[model samples]
Target: MNLSTEVRRLRDMDWGELDIKESGGWPFLLQLICCVLVLGLTLAGTYWYLAAPKLEELGQARTEEARLIRDYQSKAAQAAHLEVMREEMAILEERMNTLRDMLPTGAEVPSLIDNISEAAISNQLSIEFIRLRSPVSQEFYVEQPFDIRVRGGYHRIAEFLANVASLPRIVTQHDLTLEPMEDAGGEQLQLSMLARTYSYRQSGEEEEAP
Candidate 1:
């Protein structure tokens, strides 16, 4: 049919006159309109089903991009202070090494005890006894306690303790007791002390310890 006649016929069609069972006998333009409407609806439904997952995926991609941007900003800020962090780490390492040196290893225990005797002799104090007690094990080191007895003037004993404190290795004096020696005309005093020194435990020695 011509365009104008088709348009007029579509506009003049009566909905009440149409029957579902008689759609085959409907007007030519009306049948064509029905086919177009059904096709359009089918295409729309198919598009929605196909595109929904992709739309959800796009939203997830945007969320992932935002999270990555936040992480980059945080790491960039840390990188800006990287040199300062490295310097702090170096200082901590140096401090750890110094502490390690201050704590003597097990092999140096006898030499350390000899040094204590030498300290007392240097102070002109007569060493009565410098006894080593059994080593007490701890989490990281062993405590080597000493039972020390010496005879000297009060000032000499003070000088001896000061020299002990000035030793390169760490040694701590504890539980000091003093009594007058009557045989020396009360001019000498007997100083009894408990001293402690620490030694570093060797690695893997813990399992081998009896």
Candidate 2:
């Protein structure tokens, strides 16, 4: 009875009970709150330090990629336009060359004149007045002729005319005045004629053979 009562009295004592309550009190609760706060702060710091920069870099990369894509598309469009222009230029060049080949070259004038003179001699006609002049009208087939005047017998004149008619190129006589010569011989006659030679020429371009 003595031991049991003493133990009971000690348990019911206010100091002992207060000491037991203080042993496990608000300090522990404050330490637990501090630890929880530290853990939360560490997690927040980790997210800011590690994840934030990566997110920023990803956003920057997306922006740069978009810019590059736009540049590539613009360049592609320009390339297509250049290709079309090149094709058009090639076609134009081909057409221009074809037209050039179809046009005649004017380099045969000397030979043509020699042939005409030979034909005149073969026809027994001596050329007296052979005059060449620049074009007058500058229009096609309406220009003045290269002038020529001759004095010969009537048969020689007729033969010369026939020879001119047989030429390959178009040769025509204009402004003809035929009369008898006053020289002592009655067989001789005086002939005046104008002949025309032509070639083609465009504005600002050199003359060409036709």
Model 2 residue 207 distance off true place after TM-score fit, in angstroms: 7.7
Error of 2 at 81 (Å): 38
In candidate 1, what are the lDDT values of residues 67-124, reduced to their tens digit?
Answer: 9999999999999999999999999999988988998777888899899999889888
Q: All candidates' TM-scores?
A: 0.61, 0.43
Please report, as a residue range, the 10-residue window in candidate 1 with the lowest summed lDDT: 201-210
Residues 1-210, candidate 2: write the lDDT tens digits: 365755665455565234534544434444455689999999999989998999999999999999999999999898979989899999999986675443323454455566668877887777786666665444432233566666688988888877876666556778888888778367788778877654545556643233
In candidate 1, how many clashes are counted?
0
Q: What is the number of backbone collisions in each predicted candidate, taken in the order shown?
A: 0, 0
Native-vs-model 2 lDDT? 0.68
TM-score of 2: 0.43
Report the C-alpha displacement of residue 170, candidate 1, in angstroms.
Answer: 1.1
After superposition, the stretches of candidate 2 with alpha carbons farther than 4 Å from their true spots are 1-106, 137-144, 202-210
